[model samples]
Target chain A: MDIAYFPGCSLHAMAHEYDTSTRLVCQRLGINLYEVPDWNCCGATAAHSLDHHLSVGLSSRNLALVKDMNLKQMTTPCAGCFNRLKTASVELKQNDDLTAEIEKLAGISLTGAKEVEVAHTLQVIMEAVGMEGIKEQVIKPLNGMKLAAYSGCLITRPRAIAQFDDPEQPVALDHLLQALGAQPVHWSHKAECCGGGFAASDTDIVVDLGGQVLEAARQAGAEAIVAACPMCQTNLDTRQRAIEDERGIKYNLPIVYFTQLMGLAFSYSPRQMGLNRLLTSPTTLLRSRGLS
Target chain B: MSADFYKPMRLNEIDSSLQEEIKKVCDINVELCMECGKCTGGCSNAHIFDYTPRKIVQLVKLGAEKTLLSMDALWTCVSCQLCVDRCPSQINIPHIMDYIREKAHRQGVKTRRINVELFHDLMLNSIRKTGRVAEAPLMLNFNLRSRQYMKDAVLGGRMFLKGKLSPFSPVVKDIDHVRRLFKKIADNREG
Candidate 1:
């Protein structure tokens, strides 16, 4: 279960919780996460927008680095990084001409690491730690803790590229939540865009679209929302207050990363799961229910 | 990356007057258009707009100002950014759309239903405070403004009943950075 890990930029800074929780949960689940040697940014949102070839070239350099490491697989925690790497890999794998051009530009050669899977942390968890194992591991079992799973656009979109799950309706996270003995509420906007990078340049659309997803989750009776992407976490949990103020209604739902919840159900403390980093406290609810 | 993939079915070039205005706003070279139509295909509003991505680029290239601005199609974009994400040419069609829509708004050419513009105001207001988009409050404001609050009244009440939406503001870590960014964008618009 050992794999090369790329934490990307945000995981070390703003999303320290995701980084810490990922390490801790992998430890508990008997999986190994070795940081990719001297890894760099995946050229996530910015590189892709500014120049197509430059973005692919930059991503190819990272991939070529991994290929040089001789690693067969790499697991990424951030959804953006995952998408970037996978997109580049898909392009390189499918378009030989593109690979040759990018290699020329990047000054590196990719030996086409066959089936060298580039996967999100969630997919790795789902595959390595099956639902049955997860259910058995649940010491706290978020019992009756209603949750709406937000599977934003990246991991599931541009259908031809990612193919992680269903494009329109994804249920991988939902299935995982239900197996963990919690109620996973149904919502239609699960696959909607969270306006990731646009949040910086176009704030208005980000809130408006993100709000719709949150509202739908709320309507479906979720006590909190679970997401795999940190951007979604930032939008739903951190910016939730402004959404409230702008519209003059309250949405106090706790936003938790899937791994954090896994850590909790596996008998880990808030400290172990980095729950303190969250703006909305779900730990208190867990403690009140005598689970923490 | 094949530039020939999107052959414009109609309106290969825009009118000159509209071209100058669009170029002034976008300021980026629309001539680098590669004719990819990725923008049109991924646009969330394309379903509602007559100008597909190919058509929009064609219009911009031909400088079709009167037709582009006069149409209500520009206002329907949610700006979710799918087109921007997929565009191989790296053209920010949404930004172009925004500039066009803003121009239309200034000229008093608006929709009978102003959902996108209203959403924009609420969204910007939310981001100014939190540095990100918050859902519950934005929805409430959007619903209230659109006078469709009753549509999701039960859901809203249920959320309140379950403490999903709260009255207290959540802590934002970098309020100043957010304020500065918002102000800079706003100032740029006015100038």
Candidate 2:
């Protein structure tokens, strides 16, 4: 019924559309999202790269805050944040000293640390709002639009930490897209890295990796790419033109949030879901399909 | 995926302290790596990294701290963990890479692919000040600082036009606590 939500840094800014759509979609499902009070950065790729303690501290702090909210279930839409939070939870269970230290900082003992569990929004959607629950609520069937469901790196990698879906070949996002009447395209590089964390400083890597994913989707004849993480959406949407220019190919692929597509199926307005915020501009594809 | 580097490493010159630090931080049994390049072969960013996953662990086990810390290989690892999943030894290659990155960042080693280090610091600086990242300014500042202006300028312009680049990024009320949290952790005051 109620769950602690940690949108992380991206959802509030570059990924605000993701947050908007996720919130609206969750609301339609009668789910309440109590955002973790005073949630800080998850200390993503940067924090962990700089200091292990800081990364753990940053992520574990949010988990501790979720406990403060009297909730054991925590969810984040960002794959990066989800992985960091899940890592903290899984690591805390491994080392008693680290758990004790985190407890000391949180002012709670190990026994009292109410088994905080972290879930990506994809898993949350799949488990909390099953396919049947979702199918019943769809007003727009998506009219069988072809889309590539991209889960990105962190959602289903490092097997032990993120055990939600298969690391190599995840079909949860594909299944959800299918439930909404969208044809989930079968692409080999669907679960590949999007060079998400390196988008800014190392744009080249992001270009290469993101380009590869987009190229694969294009090869599979996908009209758009559906992603559960903001970073994947950012990379897929922001760098498409450049990849096209460099590779001498044409892929006018519109990268969209899974929730944004869900919002469309739920008959939410474009403005309500921040649909216009997508950098790649889904106008043509959505217009062609009579979606928006 | 250019495999053009040929640097021979001798096993006789291992530094115990560095090995201990890497082992302690990463919590990996590097000795179990059977020279199986599966980790390196499975790496997504090995094309961009100088020290591939298996080589990173091999270097850490060899205690080649100077060589490992000198390159920007650590930052290139997006932590996809494909290597870890494929490793028969189950070596936590990404964690080891994270350890190397933490060390590189601490030592302030600036070398090839150094822009990634700038990116990491700028992101941390943004987060430390705002409690969350302001992407527009973060990207702008990162590009300006790293001199990568031409890469995403047009894309950013389009994003701004689309209303994706928000000018106002909220700073958490507990800004002081965030500042302290970062400071204490960086100063090695916390576990």
Candidate 3:
């Protein structure tokens, strides 16, 4: 399947592994990712706080760009970007005045009301590729590697905008993990808030909230947590030391993007999937299981 | 022994106009909140927030504008929207929080959580100039502006060493168009 892609900011820098893995897995699965031309920031978490029309205008610019492409669909790996784009689409479609104002501000007519269908990569993989299709393409099963799927907020909240997922207890990530021959551990915080976009400003809240998610995943006996959102990845993977210091326990849990694990199951090397670039190394565990 | 007598003690500072503005701007039906406390119960940052999600709603409904605007809760709200998902009332707590924060920021209310606001503003400016954020410079700028020097020093070092921090800002093609968009937004110069 061919689709326009928006990598967001994280995929370019902090979460490049997610981007590379996404590319690798998509290649293996026969999916085409045509990046949206000259995409700007989706105005996540920031613009809405500053001005509502600004957020809608900024995010809808990408939608307008994609609409100009005559592309019926666009996919994003970052939950923040996905949420902003989806929100803008919903807002633009619902409010004719809003749509007119933003379109005029952006100097481009938005086709979001017509043909644009925004989706996250996990949705595309599970729904478009199908579990059986993914299972068939798995050259190397994950050997039952325990993975706790973490679906942070923005992807499923308010249910109306995201329009999919079991908002409280999402299972799409679990389904994708299972298809890759990984064990999807039963965990409650799969759809919990991860103190997103706060890691930079309020580090304490992220450490505390991220600690809860990691500890819960750990208590569920998950070897590692998998996330679709870069905010979740950075919060969980980047600050384990602080969480450990605060909680007085060692949680050496590595957070991997779902696409990276899928790439591993599909026989893509660590280098190819950019797994080696992870802050918290997945090497030792993969090597221990002779999967590396 | 009705609760109304006791309520006035805590809710004496009500401004009805604030409630009307919040409803108009944030689109939150604060009146729909049944005082279930489910939003507070599910709030991930409740411990940090001066007023938890349910209290914020109640306060807004009661028009506790000064309390809502002056306090750190408006700034500390992480905007995760768990309250929105779980709220039977369908109150978009995060959007309301954003609305309150925006209002407060515009009113020049100094907050204990100023760093969060600074970070958000910095992000907007960064995007305005660079088109996309360069992790290294963005973090450096955030640290410098927030005045909490080197908070992520060790992390930044490790990330730079690992090539995660791109020294050069990525300016997208047709960046002039992006600049024009920013100018339009900043000046309300378009449409």
- Fraction of native A-B contacts kept, per candidate: 0.01, 0.77, 0.65
Worst 10 residues of 1 chain B by lDDT: B1-10
Docking class of 1: incorrect
RMSD of 2: 2.7
Of the two candidates 1 and 2, the one with more favorable TM-score, higher being better, is: 2
Native-referenced DockQ of model 1: 0.05
Cα-based lDDT for every prediction: 0.68, 0.81, 0.82
Q: Of the candidates shown, which would achieve the greatest lDDT relative to the real structure?
A: 3
lDDT of 3 at A66: 87
Off by over 4 Å in 1: A112-115, B1-191
Give stretches of model 3 more than 4 Å off.
A111-114, B1-15, B188-191
Per-residue lDDT of candidate 1, residues B1-191 (tens digit) = 12432556354443466666666644556777888777776665565566676677777776666666766566545444467557776676765775666566557665543665566556546645654445566667777887765744654564454444544333346356335534543454567
Candidate 2 docking: what grade?
A: medium
Per-candidate DockQ values are 0.05, 0.65, 0.63
Number of clashes recorded per candidate: 20, 0, 0
List, residue by residue over B1-191, the lDDT tens digit for candidate 2.
Answer: 22323556455755767768756755777888899799888788888776677777766776767777776676677878899899998888777777777766666677677777787888889878988888788778877887766867777778878777888777888777677767765555433
**Candidate with better DockQ, 1 vs 3:** 3
